[model samples]
Target: MKLSVWTYEGPPHVGAMRVATAMNGLHYVLHAPQGDTYADLLFTMIERRNHRPPVTYTTFQARDLGSDTAKLFRDACQAAYERFKPQAMIVGASCTAELIQDDPGGLGAALGLPIPVIPLELPSYQRKENFGADETFLQIVRTLAKPTDRSARVSCNLIGPTALGFRHRDDITEITALLNDMGVEVNVTAPYGATPADITRLGAAHFNVLMYPETGESACRWMERTLDQPYTRTIPIGVGATKDFVEEVAALTGCIPRLDTDRLRLPWYSASVDSTYLTGKRVFIFGDGTHVATATRIAREEMGFEVVGIGCFNREMARPIRALAKDIGVEALISDDYLEVEGRISNLAPELILGTQMERHIGKRLGIPCAVISAPVHVQDFPARYSPQMGVEGANVIFDTWVHPLVMGLEEHLLHMFREDPEFNDAAGPSHHAHGAKQVSDAPDPIGAQIIWLDEAERELRKVPFFVRGKARRNTEAFAEARGDSQISVETLYEAKAHYAR
Candidate 1:
C-alpha cells in the first residue's frame, strides 16, 4: 500500500501552529482563514500548556482568497499588535495563504511598529512542519536582527530550541545548564522562553549555537553576513558530540560547556542494560537530517547498533544525508515521496525501525517493531518523561525505546522461558482466547506480540530505585492516564459523538 505525503491532502499546519502557540511570550499572527486557528488545541491539550497560543487569524476564507487579502493582512497586524502587546511579532500564513502569496513580510516592514516584526512566507506547495519551524525561526531572526555600531555583547543565541522538535523538557534544561557552564549568558532561545526584546537582542549574541540543524544553516549565514557573528554548526545530540559541541562553543565564545561526567550515569533506560540488547542490531532510521545524523552517531558509537537503512524528508539535507548514507556504505532513502520511503524500508528489512509516524504504519504492515524517530509524532509517542533524542540522556532514551521493541519485557521473556522449560510449564494447563483483530490468511502480524502497556511497566518499575522511579512514574502515568479509557474506541467522526455520549 502506498501513502502520499503530498501537501494539503495529508495533515495541515496544525502541528506548526502548535509549536508557535506553545512558546511563552511570542505571538503568532497567522494570515490564514478562520479554521486554521485550530492549531491552538494541539498545544493547549496535547502539550498541556496553560494558555492558548496567542494567534490571530486573518479570517480570509475561500471567499476572501484573492480579493483584498492585503487589507486583511494590515488589519491582522494592527489588531494583533493592539491585542497581544507581544514582545516580537511573527507574521505568517498557512498552506492556504501560501498559495495566495499575500506578502506579510512587506506588510510587517510597512507597519513600522516599535517592536521587531518578522514576516514568515511558508508555502504549502513545498514544505512541511519541520520546514515551517526552520523557515520561521531563521526568517524571524533575520528580520528582527538589529545592527548597531556598538561592540558585540558577551551574549549568545540558542537556535532551533522549539517545543515539538525536541519536546523533551530535560533537553532545554540540559542546554541551559551547558550554556551557563560555558559562562556565555544566553541572549535568546526561541519558542521556549524568549520575549520580543530577547528576539530583537538576537543580534547582540556574539555567537549562535544551533540546537536543531533545520534552523541552523540559514540563520548562521544571515547572522554572519549581517551581524558578523559566526554560528557553531555542530548540534549536541549524544555524550561525545555534546562534549565536543560545548568545547567548540567554548573555543568560539570562550565559555566551556561543563562536561557532565555523570552523562553516562543519567537515569536512562536504553543507555543502560537495554542498549546492551540492541548491540549489533541491524536498524533502519529516517527523519529530519539533524536527528537522523545525531542518532546515527549514537546508534553506532554509543549504542553499538548498525544503521542499515537511512533516509530523510528534508530537501535541505539531501547533500548531507546522501553523503552520510554513502559513508556508512549504504544507499540513503532521501525523498519526499512516501512510496519511495516504503520501498527503501522494504529493501532494508531491519530488525527495528526508527522513523516517522508514517513509517510506524509501514513497519506494522511489514511485521517489524518500530519507534517514531522524527517529526509528526502522535499523542501516543509523547511519553511524559523528559525524553529528548539529544544529549547523553537523549541517547539513553533512544537506546531504550528502540531496544524495548526488540527485547520483550522481563515478564514476557520470563513467561516465554518458563513455557519452554519442562519443569515450569509441565504442571499447568493452557487456556486460549479468541484472536479478534483484523486477520488475514494466517500471516504473521503484531497481534500476538506483547504491547508493554504503561500499567504493566509501572507495576514493575516500583522495584527500581526511588530517584528514577518518580520521574519515570510521572512520565509513564501522564501518558497512560491521559490516554484515557482503553475500552472506548471511536472509529470515525460519527462514532466519536456516540462514544462521547455513551
Candidate 2:
C-alpha cells in the first residue's frame, strides 16, 4: 500500500530551490536532468516573477550514463560558479538525479573550493515537496550556524517558508515583525532570503521557530547543542497556536506578546453563530500527517465537525494521525493507492473531504464538496492571494474555505422546497438533476475541469505538423494510459526508491 506519481505544490525541487535562491547572497547547483528546469515555473507561474531559478543541473542523459557522470556533475558545478560567483552554494539533487548517485558534495569537498558548499540530499523518492524545502533549509543552517559576538545575545531563527502553509511572504513579514516586536533579533529565517552568513548566524539565535514541521528539525537540534538556543516545538497553525507561539517567544526573550484580538474574535464569533449552522458536518481528512493531526484537533475541538475518517501518505508523521483516528472512534484508512483512498471514501460517506488534489477527483466523482487542505497540489492552489493555513489568519481562511462551499443557500432553498412541496417529496423516485454535485437552478452547469497545463500542452502539440502531432498524441495517450488515474499510497510515495529497487 503506497502512493506514487502525485502532483505537488510545484516541481519537487522548487521548494528547496526557492530557499536557496531567496538568500541575499547565495547560489545552488542542483544535480538533475535538463528537463528539471521546469522549476522556473514556480517563480513565474506561482510567485509571478521574471527572474530565473538559481540552480545548475548536471543533466546527464542515457548517452552520457556511461561517460564520467561524476565529472559531468563537477563541470556543471564549476560552470555555475564561473557564471554566478556565489559566495555559498548548495549541492543538491532531485527525484531523477537521486536515482543515479552523483555525489557533488564530496567533489566540492575534495576540490577544496574557495566558496562554501553545502551538500543537500532531498531525494523525492522518500519525501514530499515540503520535506525537501525544510530539509534543504536545515542543512544550510547546520552547515553555517555559528555564534557571533559572544556577548551579542539577541538570538532567534525563523525556519520554514516554501509557500504551502504559512510559507507565504506575508507570513515571513508578520513573523519577522512579531519577533522584532519581541526584542529577539532573528539571526536567520530559513529559505526566506537567508544567505550562508545568515545561516552561520543560526547558532547565534537562542531558539528556532519551526513555522512548519516538515523541515527544520536538523538545524533546531544543531543550534540547541552548539549555541544552547532551545527551539520551540509550537507551530503557529491556528488562532490559539499563533497566540501561544507569540507568548512563548515573549516568555523566552522577555518581550510583551502582541495580539490582534480582532483576528481571534471572529473565529469565536463565527463558531458560536454559524458552526451550529454547520454542525455535525460529516467530513473526512487525508494527506500529510501534520495537517491530518492538527486539523483533526481543530475540526473536532473547534469546528464541531464529525470527522468520519482520516489518513495520510506520510508515514513519518502518521502515528499522531493514527492516534487521532482512534480518538475520533474511526478506523484510520492509511493507504496511498488512489483506488484505496477512493474506496475508503465510501466508508466515511462524508459530505465534504479535506485532502490533497487527488481527492478532488474522488470528491467530484462521489459528488462530495472538497477543499484541498494539504499538498500534492496543482497550479490551481497557487492563488494570487496570500493563503497560508498556519496562524490565526489561517484559521479564518480555513473557516471560510470549508464553510462557504457547503453552505450553498441554494441547497437550503432546495431542501426548503422539498419540505414544502408535499407532492414533490412523495413522487421522489429518479430525478433529472445530478445527485451530489448540486448546481444552481438558473445557472448552466460547468463542464469537467481539465488539468490546465496538460490540456494546453496537448492543444499546442496538436498544432504541429501531422507527423509530429501524430507521434506526440500517441506518446501522450500512452503515458496517460499507463498512469490512468492510478491511486497512490503513502508508503508507495514515501518509499518509491525502496520499492523501485526491490
lDDT of each: 0.64, 0.65
For residue 30, what is the lDDT in candidate 1? 78
* Tens-digit lDDT track of model 1 for 342-381: 7777655666678877777666555456777777566666
Q: Could you estimate the TM-score for every candidate?
A: 0.73, 0.75
Candidate 2: tens digits of C-alpha lDDT, residues 1-502: 1445654334346667767656656777777777787767756665555567777778778888777888888888888888888878888777777777777778766666788888876757656665677677777776776666532766677876654343356567666665766677776677666667666656656677876566566666776787788777776666667778888887876778876656554367555755576677778898877677777777776777888899987555667778878878998876666678887875445667888888877766655667887766666776767765766667777777777656653354355346436555412321322344422221111221221224345345434332122333333433433455232233222233243345
Steric clash pairs (candidate 1): 87-196, 88-196, 237-391, 270-400
Top model number, TM-score:
2
Instruction: Report RMSD (Å) for each prediction in the order shown.
Output: 13.7, 14.8
Instruction: Quote the lDDT for 18 in model 1.
Output: 44
TM-score of 2: 0.75
Q: Candidate 2: deviation at residue 84, Å?
A: 1.1
